[model samples]
Each structure stands twice: as C-alpha cells, then as structure tokens.
Target: MNFIESELLRIFVGEQEKLHHRPLYELLVSEALERGMAGATVFRGLLSFGLRHKVHTSKIFELAGELPMVIEIVDITEKIEEFLPVVEALLRDSGAQSLVTREAVRQWTT
Candidate 1:
C-alpha cells in the first residue's frame, strides 16, 4: 500500500451553466481528463444555493428547474495548482459565477 499528500479541488456550479452551448460540467471533466489528472468526479445535488442565496432544488418548481452541480478533482499539488486557473477561466468564459475550494488530503494508491 502507498499514499501521498494530494490536493482536492471542489467546484460548485449550476446544471444549466454552459460554455459555448455545451454543459459546463462536461467541459470541466474533459479538462481534467486532458490534463492527465489522477481522477475527477461530478456530483449533482438535489438542493443547493450559492453566495447569491438563490436556492435550487429537485422539486421541479422550487428552483425553476435548476439544480446544483459539483465537480471534484484530486491530484498532485502542482497539478491542482496549475489547473486552478483553468477552472477560473472557464467560469469567466461562460459568464457564470461559482465557488471553488481546494484542500490537502492523503491519497491512496495501488
């Protein structure tokens, strides 16, 4: 067994946000893949809100059909740090705002 200290980047976004008419989530994962990162995961939330305090939910009516999306990527510190700016650029290009968090953790490897 082996383990190493890695960085985890968690991005909070909306399902409807798009970049060039494509889903933002798709682009996020694709970028991570292209970067040769260790791994990435996307989680769709049934209910969530951001700094704007606007609530989005799966109730269909509560959020007006919008749900929260979270993209999490884990990799080496250098990789994560390098990718951080890319994420910001995507958000800017899409004209959307999101919350991104990065932290350190132990990553297990085979």
Candidate 2:
C-alpha cells in the first residue's frame, strides 16, 4: 500500500443557496472537477447551524430545502491550498453565508 499526507477541504452551505442560478453544491463539484481535483463528494446534512446559530433541520418524511449541504474534497496539501481562494471567491460572489474548513488527512492506495 502507498499512502500520502493529504488535506481535506470541507464546505458547508444551505441547500437552497445558489450561484449563477445553479445549486451551490453542483457549482462546487464542477469547479473542483475543472480544477483537476482528486474528487468531490456532496453530503446532505440532517441538522446544522452556523454563524447566526439558526438551526436547520429537515426530517426525511417532510420536504425541506433549508437543510445543510456539505461538499468535501481531498487531495495533496498544495492542491487544496491553491483551491482555497477560489472557493472563497465563489462563496463571496454568491453572497452565501457559508463555512469552509480544512484538515490534515492520510490517503492510502493499494
């Protein structure tokens, strides 16, 4: 097995938020792909709150669009660092109240 030190980039946004009239998650994933990222994955969160501390929850049985969405991408630290400003710019351009974070990780290949 081969392993490398990596960085995990995580973006948090509301499901209803949009950029360029497109879903933010979709835009983020497309941007990552266009930047030649290792990969991007989006996860819908059940309950979440940030900044203003307003809670958002959407039960599976009910229809709701305010729930949180998380976009994750993992790659080498340099790639992730290079992508940070682009993510920030996108968020700013969208005027989205969002969160972006990064952490160290290990990626293994067999």
Model 2 bad stretches (over 4 Å): 60-63
lDDT of 1 by residue, 1-110 (tens): 79999999999888889998899989999999999999999999987776777877787675754787899999999999899889989999998778889899889989
Q: Quote each prediction's TM-score.
A: 0.91, 0.91
TM-score, cand. 1: 0.91
Candidate 1 stretches with Cα past 4 Å from truth are: 62-64
Local accuracy of candidate 2 as per-residue lDDT tens digits, 8-103: 999998888998899988898898999999889999998877777777777644536888889999999999989988899889998987888889
lDDT of each: 0.89, 0.88
